[model samples]
Each structure stands twice: as structure tokens, then as C-alpha cells.
Target chain A: MNSRLKFLLLNLFLLCSLSAMAQEKINIGEKQAISSAILNEKREIWIHLPKTYNDSSISPAKYPVIYLLDGEINFEYYTGMSDFLARPPYADMPECIVVGIKNTERTRDLTPTKSQKKSPVNPNVILFGDSGESENFVRFIQEELKPFISKNYRTQDYSILVGHSFGGLFAVNVLLTHPEYFNAYVANDPSLWWDNKVLISKTKSYLEKNKTFPAHKFLYVSQANNEEQNKNWNSEMTQAIEEFKGIVEKNGSLNYKHHFFESEVHGTVSYPGNYDALKFIFKGFRTDIKKLSKNPQLLEEEYKRFSEKAGSNFTPSETYLNVVLKFMKSNDFKESEDYFINLKNSLYPKIK
Target chain B: MNSRLKFLLLNLFLLCSLSAMAQEKINIGEKQAISSAILNEKREIWIHLPKTYNDSSISPAKYPVIYLLDGEINFEYYTGMSDFLARPPYADMPECIVVGIKNTERTRDLTPTKSQKKSPVNPNVILFGDSGESENFVRFIQEELKPFISKNYRTQDYSILVGHSFGGLFAVNVLLTHPEYFNAYVANDPSLWWDNKVLISKTKSYLEKNKTFPAHKFLYVSQANNEEQNKNWNSEMTQAIEEFKGIVEKNGSLNYKHHFFESEVHGTVSYPGNYDALKFIFKGFRTDIKKLSKNPQLLEEEYKRFSEKAGSNFTPSETYLNVVLKFMKSNDFKESEDYFINLKNSLYPKIK
Candidate 1:
């Protein structure tokens, strides 16, 4: 090739390569060690901030943080879900930060009690097997991790604790013992049957002594068919919560929701339950889809509230309406259709 | 202080240091390229075979394969879902080999047409822009990739094609032009609006001239509010299909299903849609949940069918029942509850 042609081709190649590299791999970010404490040695952490997080033009923005356990498995699931949920109209949920805590010793960190027999993998190893360290794990979160996160990120006071299996057990333990730690709690098919329902029994005793759990929301969910197995332990867990709900009703301090996911199981119920939990806990603040349809002004008012509450300068757009409608329909919330139409009318009143 | 003690302590320190070094970081696998003659390039591919896949005792079993596009992003998503789905009753969706085609040039490979406007990003200056390289892409799968995959792995003829967005568009293109490429095609929020509805228009033309497509299943889905912005165009696309549906009904040679995701978006709709599509498409082949509840024999019959079809001697366990029930409830297919129960009963008649 000619010298000029070769030079042009080289420049073009460099530009294309740069552009391809710049397209941004959809990575949330790298995993990093958040704490150096000896107990925190095996624990790694990952955080996902939204794409709009760095935009200074979008000011005064703060996000709710979701602290998830079993980060190695669920970090990506929540990250992907949060990314899509924060996109448009059902923009009811803000683009929050997701903090995933990787487990070092799942049994030690997640379980409240040191049950020697429960752990079948190792019978001889004392410290490595059935060694309870949940109290220390919670301390790590409350003292070290939370403080570091609050200092580093633009965050709202609102926080959520999510867990599955043993993680679910940990979430419940935290919610019961340190209720002030999180605004919302989701226990996805928790092992309430742990240690012959030690947690459940302790929960019953805790409710007797404690009059209230503040203004926090607790969602206890179980999959449908697990009722027939293990002597219907899931139903019993729900019943225990129902008893706790009675105590909360008498005290009028805690708002508790019990959902029996008759279709879900221990492992696969997290996805739908998590989505529903977010919707349920925020139901009080949800935009009135019905009222909005009758009046375009209502939709605008709701958007204003969303922006104000989320502490972001988010405007309701066409894309937003599409997203809201989609989420509503998928969750079988069809009653909100007219509200979505009203939202569309209000947002793009000039289009027609 | 003794010389012998000092030597032993030094050796212990060295061993501890080596162990720490090994445990410090995770071993992320190295990237590799897969050669394909049809594309005439070594495409980057990601392969994840399950832990059970390597077991020689389970040899001579041909596993089903799932081919995913936008592998870099959606590969993990499907991997997680498949991991969860294959566990229990939902185990109807067998454990399969996952092949993720990592994108080197997404726009070039994914887009069906080579438009001048969108072609500027092409580095090769091959004028593949708007040139319709989908045929070549399909040929690469048929001629090169498939042969390589079949040669390397014990793969059954049953294969599934999963794609999202532009990848989804490509999936639909392959399904229409080359129906025999895969047994099932999952097009999640395909960009039917691409090139001003070029694919949909082409589909209309193809259907008009065609006598019938092969015996295959096609799943066309759109996120809930996706229709709100370009209602006219979206409706036009739907109308085109409806027109084709009329034609298909008269001839009765093809099987197609259209799902309107009123609650999902282009980005977030894939999870629910993919789950539902798999459930719906494979509904009849598996034991009817309701039937299984009433008759233990039905569950065994369904298992036999599943085993025969999959070419694997897999049986549904209690864990599988829990997972399937969880999935059905999460998707709000409560009506299928009876069928699931029946299937469970058939699988484990003694339990019920």
C-alpha cells in the first residue's frame, strides 16, 4: 500500500479499537476487600454504582443501599435487576447501590448458633465446622462496612438487608436483634428450622420482651410446596411470624408482611420474592396509578415526589412510562394500567 | 533457640506463605478462540460445562445445548438461572451445555443489515454494512461451530437459541430464514424497529411466498411499555405477525406464540420471558402437575419421556418439586399448580 494510505489505515484502526474499548464492558466493578480485620480475612466485597452516578449535572442524588449476603452467587442477579429497575417509569425504585458480601465461612458467618451436629461436612474440626460467628459478622457490617460505605458514597438513610438460605437466617437475626440497622428486611425461605427452631423460639421470646421493632418493614416469605416436607416447617415459620405480627399490631410500632409463596421453593424463590418485597415495602409510597390516569397533574405530582424522595433530578419520560407499565404487568399489577396511561398523557401532553 | 527447632520453624513459615499466596486470589480462566469456517474467523467463545459433565460414569449421554448471543453480558444471567432451574421440579429444563459467543464486533455481527449510517464503525472496511451477514452468521453455526461443538461434546440434536436486543433480532432472523438451526428460539424484546421494521417487513414477504416453515417453535415477545412509544410501528409489527398468523392457520405447518410483556422492559424483560417461554414450550412434554398429583404412574411416564428426550437417566427428586413449585408461583402460573402437584406425586407417589 502507499505510505499515505497505510498511515490513514493505521489511524482508522486505532480509532476503531479505541471506540470498541470505550464501549464499556457492562461490568458493575471489581471486587475489593472492604475490611482488613482478621475475622474479615476471607470476606470480599463488591459494589455496583449506576452509570448516571458520575454525572455531576445530575446533582444532589443519593441512593438507597441494598446489603446482600452470599455475594458470590447473588451479586450479579441483584446488580442486573437493579440496573434495569432504575431505568424508566416504574422508576418508583431508585438506582441504589448494591453491596455484596462474599462469604468466607457460610456456616460460621450466617448461622446464629454453633450447632455441632448440624454441620455434616466436618465432624472433627472444631473451629472450621459449626463455629458460630454471626455476632462478629453483624458487628463487621455495623461498625466497619456501613461506616466506610456511608463515608464513601452519596447514600440515603434508607437501607435494605437481603438474604437467602443461611443468609436469610442471618437477615432475620439482624432484623430481630438490631432492628434499627435497616429500613427493610427480606428473608427468602429462611432456615427457621435451624437448630430445632432455635431462632424461631428466640424470636418468640424476643417479641414477648420487646414491645416494638420501630417503623421498619419485615417481609417473611416461603416457597409453596415445602409445606409437605420437614413436617411443614415453612408454614410453622409463617405462623410464628403471624404470632409476631399480632404482637406488633398490639404495639403499633412494626409493620410486618408475611407472604407464603406457594409456587416458589427454598432456592428459586428469591427472584420473585425480592421483586415483590421491594414493591410491597414501598407500596405506601407508590404512585397512585389509578388517580394519575384521571388527572395528568397527579402524575406530575407523583414524579415530583419521586424526585424529591430519591434526592435525584429525575424527570418522567416516555421511556419511564414503558418501564413502569412493564414492571406492573409482569408482577400482575394490571390495575395500574390506567395510571400508566395518565402518566404518559401528563409527561407527553404535547405529543398528541 | 536450638538449631533443629529454628530449621523446622523456618520451613513452617515458608509453607504458610505458599498456602496464603495460593488462597489470595481466585483463578479466572484464560480466554480462548473457537474457529468457524462459515464466518471465516476465529470467534471468541466461552464454554461452561457443569461439574457433572466431566464425570465419565455419565458418559455416552448426549446433553442438550444452549447457544446465547451477547454472551459477555447474558451468559452469567442464563448460567445463574439455569443453575437454579435445573435443580428441582423445574428440572424439566435439563442441565445443558452453555455456549456463549463473545462479541468482537457486536454491531457488525448482530445487525442483519449493513446500513451506511450504522456502518461507519466497521474497522475492516468490508462494506458488510447493511449487507445482511446474518446468512453467513447462520452458515458459520451450521457448517463450523456446530460441527466443532458436536465433535467435542456429547450433544443431542435438541438445541436452544437465546438472544436479547440486537442479538434477539438476529435470533428472529435465523428462526425465519433458517428454521432448522435450532429446536427452540427465544427472542427477548427483539429490535423489530431496526432499519425501519426491515425484519418484520421481510418476515411479511417471506411468509407470503412460503408454503410453511419446518416443525419448529418460535417465541416473539415485547416488554410491557415498549409498545407505548412507537405504538403505531409496534402495532404494525404485531399486525404483520397477525397477518402471518392468519396465513399459518390456513396452512398449519408452523408453531408460533406471541407474548406481550406488559410488565417488563426491553432491558429487564428477559428473565421472566425466558423462564416463561421455556416453561410454556416444554409444558406438554413433561408430566402434567395436576395429573401427577392424582396418579403416581403419570409422574414416572413423564420422567420416562424427559429421560428419553434428553437421552439421560435423570429422575425428579423432592428438591426438584420444590424448585418447580417455586418457579410456577413466582411466574404466577397458579393454574399450573395442580399439574405440578400431580407431577410431583407421580414422581414420588409415596410422599403424597
Candidate 2:
């Protein structure tokens, strides 16, 4: 090769290598697929394991799973939020595995009844044309998706279902149909106006028949500002949600909390609403670090109480115990340090 | 080869390929590096571009930048949060490019004064031994980092600075030292007790000399529940922050908001605090989409008012205008649709 050509090639190689080094990708999760017989198709799933899931220093741990609907839109932020909220020494909730289920036919899967409506904007046009096969969709999740997750990951018995809009309607429907599927449900700006408030009737009938929600079941519903929504369409959305709220509150047997975000519209409520829902569902999970320094046994006592209220056992993870031990050692709390060390050893035994 | 051996090899090949297909990574951002003369070292940066940054359908756009501190910890959630908030039709803020600067020497870069203190837990050991080089650090951001971002990305003139704890102290210090660097500043549970309230002194002196903050400058400070903090250490944190709040509020010239989170502690306050800070800083950004359908001119009017308050020029993006156009067309608002088509064409003209 000519000397000039060799010099140019070397320069090109250096530039390419530099650019490659600068473009390291930041990955939050990975995709997986399941051949679901019920759905008669290959369903794709996005899974985000907690940071400690692969740490070799700690014992392998089981995390509660959150099955989130509308996966493509919400997965990235939801996973990051869960990890942030579950940071140890001041964790608001236990570390969780986030499973984001993407939609193929969103309207068909999320709606509960075969009903259609004329467009709010143009009366001649129909909305939700291929609507209402939630029973089959729920079956796909409960039978196929749940089994796939459990068989693959170290998951706790506790699980939560999270959805927005029609997904929110699905979450409410699943709670009514299969309360045993998940311990908690979050509905963000749900389309309760569906089929002229069929879910409202279902909620009332369920309460009348059962007399109470299943023990330890939690439901968090967030309603967005309806003033702007009223300008767009009829006030049916607000009316339906209010009616459902009144029925639930009057029965007073369910662990329910409803928040009305005055500033948030339908599209934006899920971000803040999801944050608030985690805080509410796991209200007693955070134990004071200062108190833990003086009285280390309080850690186990607090966890026990939280577990009792949660209706599921939630032991402090090996990662959290390690943080507690480090805090104690650095602060010169000898007794507390010894207590946590013993606790860690007992919970996560080393293999001989 | 024997039939059994051939079959085994074929099975192994299928399994490997299946696993590869299933493990496709979900990426939110990418990493970049800058060999900085100001810091005298190569600094790593995490950059997240908004979804529409690379869309070919619309004209290339410029985005406001958010310089985030303690980048390694907060980068993931902060990026996702920014993208979610900037979604069209109900966007609370403009699309922003998040640049997360990972820490090399956290205490040295974030603290302002060369002062040491005894450990709150153990009086024998001192804390922050290698601290106090924030002036040089801010210089790195202004001279080195900002220039790098502006040269590489399609960045708008507007920018924001966000920090937490010691990072928060850095933000406050930079605000007092170089208010023109960022259009807005956020400090979440800032360690105002640093160096015996040195930043507090700087704030008072700055106000005394200047008599008023630069026009359109904004500052948001969030205070976590000090009740638990009091149990851990001295009440100096709450006292210093309250004193600074009083000073700023009394001056009453800067656009300022202080929130006291009753339920949040030091470790967890940044999550909610950051969300609130964004909402406060971009208070007038969200326009009623329904109203825009009736009065198309209101769109530009809203952006004009918001831009004035933000001290920067911010026109509606091509992508958002497209969303508005679609909303109008589907709603049969022919006049409004035509108006938005003209707006989009003018703002993002096509080259023949």
C-alpha cells in the first residue's frame, strides 16, 4: 500500500474505535417471548430484574412481581422508579421484578364487555370496534404468563397488577374476576365510562355478594382532573368513577385509596399516580434507620408487622441487611452490627 | 455423524438462537466521554435523547438540556421521567436532553468550602476530608461540559441544573456564583449545613449586592421530613434550610418554591422532589388541548407566555403540532386542523 493511503486508513481506524467506545448502550431490561396456547400466538414480554438479582456476594433472593399493562409506554420509567423507591436504608417498598406485557390488540384485550361507542368527536365513527375479550386475555396472563415468570425467576408469592386507561379497566375487572391472582391493583385514570359504567355495576354486585374484599387485598384508584376532560367530551368519565368510589367507600370493607390529581390530565396522571400508589400500598415498609441503630431487633419486628398487613412474608433482602451492617460498622454501633451480622448469617446461610 | 449425535447438535443450535432472540436489550440511553482540561481528567457522561430526536418524519429539533448531578444514581429514573412528562398533547414540559455527569470525586466536586467536621456518630473520626473544590467543578461544567454538549447535540439555549444532598449544595453554590449558567435550579434535600452554612452566607451577600435576582431566574428547594433526621444527627440541616428559605422569600424577587415533604426522608425525598421541581419550574407549559381545538391561536399564545417566564425562546415542536393536527382532524374541527397545518408547515418547513 502507498504511505499516504496507509496513514489515512490508520486515522479512520482510530476514529471508528473512539466512536465505538463512546457509544456504550445503557440497557434497563431485556425482552423474552412465550408461545401462549390460550392467546394462540407468541407473546413478547419485557422483564427488568432488580440490581441485586445477579450479585454473587449475596444469597439469591425472591422479589415480588409487578405485572404492568401497556408495557411499551410505561416499562422504562416504571422499572427505574421501582429500583429507586426500593433502595435500602430507607426503602419505601421491597425490591420487585417488573414484567411489562406489551399489547397486540389493546382494545380487544383490555375491555371487559363487547360494546362499542360512537366517536365523541364524530358521531358516525365507531370506537373500540374490536373490543372486549378480557376474559381470554386474563386467562392468558393467569395461566400462561404467570407460569412462565414463576418458572424462570425467583419471585415471591406477592404480585401487583398495574394499568392505565383501558388497561386500568382491565385491572379492575381482574380484581373482580380473579382476586387471588394479585395482592394489589392500581388503576390510573381508568375508562370507567366503558359500556355506560358496567364495571360500576360489577363492583357494587361483588360487594353485595361477598360483603368484603378478600383479606389484605389492596386497590388504588387515581382520577385525573375532569374539568378539561369535560370540555373534550361528556362528564360520564367523572360520573362513573365517582359512583364507583361512593359504592366502595360506603361498603368500607376494602383497603382502597382514591386520589384526585387536580393538575394532571389523563395522559399524565400515571407517572405521579404510580409513585403515590407504591407509597400507599407499602405504607409501613420503611423503618427508621436511627431506631435500628439503637435497637436492631426492631428491624425484624417491623418486617413482621409489615408482612402481616401485606398478607405475605417480606423478609429484608440480603442486600438491605448488608447495608444495615455497613451503616452500623461505620457508625461504631458494635452491638447493632453484631445483631445484623447474626441475622444475615441466619437468613442467608453459606453452602459448605 | 450418527443420527443421535446430529440431532443433539441441531437441538443445541436452535436453543442458542432462541435465547439470543429472547434476550434483546431494551436501551434508554448511551454513554459518552469528554477529556476535560478544566477537571484535568476524562469525565464520563450519560445522555438520553427524547423519542422524537431521531424521527425522520419531522424536521430535526432542538431540546432544552438538564444537567443532573449524582448522575450514576439518578440517571435512569430521571431520563425516563423527563421523557414521560414531555409526551405531547398534555405535556407538562418541553422535550429535554438529560446529561448525567457521573461522579469521580463526589465530595471534592460538590462541596464549596474546605472545612471538616467530626462524625455525628463517632466524634473521633472526621467527615469530608477531601472536600471543597466546587468553583473549579462549576468551571468544568460551564467551560468544558456545556460547550461539549452544545457542540454535539441539538440543544436549545435553555438549560436546568438538578442536584441532591451534596449535589444540591453544588447547585445552590453555582446559582449564587453563576446565575446565568442555567435558566432554573433544583435542590432536593440540599445539605445546607455544609461548612457551617457557607452557602447561606453567599445567598445573603448576593442579594445584598445585586438587590434582585436576574430576571426570569427560578429556584426550587425541597426539604425532607427532619423529624427522622433529628434522631440521626443535629437539627442543623433543617435550621440552615429554613434560614435560607426565609432569606430568599423575604427578598421575593426570584421565582422560588419550597416544599416540605412530611412523609419523605433524606434518602427518598429526591424522587418526589425532582418531580415537583419540574412541575414548579414549568408551571405554565401545559395548555388545554380541548381549548386549542376551538382557538388555534391560543397554542402560540401559551408558548409565548411560557417562554417569557422561562427566559428562553420555546416554540412548539413539530411532533407536538402533528399530534394537535391529528386531534383536530379526527374531531372534525376543520378550521383548527387547517390552522395547525399552517403552523407546522411554517415552524418545520419542508425542503424541496
A1-352: candidate 1 lDDT, tens digit per residue: 5565555556555655644543332345456677548374745787777656776543445677889888776766567666555554334366778888888778888888877542122334333365568888888888888887889888878788888877788888888788778877877777765666677667767767875555435555444345344433455655554454455456555555556666555556777677666656555343534344335356567667655543344455455466556655544455566567666666556432
Q: Compose the digit string of candidate 1's lDDT tens values, residues B1-352.
A: 5565556556555655654544433222113467776677789766655434655532234567888787765665565556455544435366677787887667667778865432232333334354457777777777877887899887767788888767778887887777777877777767665666677677767767875665445454444344344433455444543453454456666555557666554556676677666665454444444334345456667767755643345565555466557655654456556676776666556522
Ten-residue region with minimum lDDT total, candidate 1 chain A: A118-127
Candidate 2: docking tier: acceptable
- Taken in order, the candidates have interface RMSDs of 16.6, 8.5
Clashes per candidate, residues 3 or more apart or on different chains: 32, 0
lDDT of 2 by residue, A1-352 (tens): 5565556556555655644653487888889989989888888899999999999998889999999999999998999999999998789999999999999999999999999988766889988899989999999999999989999999999999999989989999999989999999999988998997999989988987999999999999999986655544437888888888998899887789999999887899999999999999999998877789989999999999999999999998899898898899988899999999999999998999
What is candidate 2's lDDT per residue for B1-352, written digit by digit as tens?
A: 5565455556555655654553498878888889989889999999999999999988999999999998889998998898898888788999999999999999999999998998877889998899999999999999999999999999999999999999889999999999999999999989999998999999989988999989999999999986655644438888888999999999999999999999888888899899999999999998877888878999999899999899899999988888898889888899999999999888888999
Model 2's alpha-carbon lDDT is 0.90
DockQ of each: 0.07, 0.44
Residue range with the least summed lDDT across 10 consecutive positions in model 1 chain B? B22-31
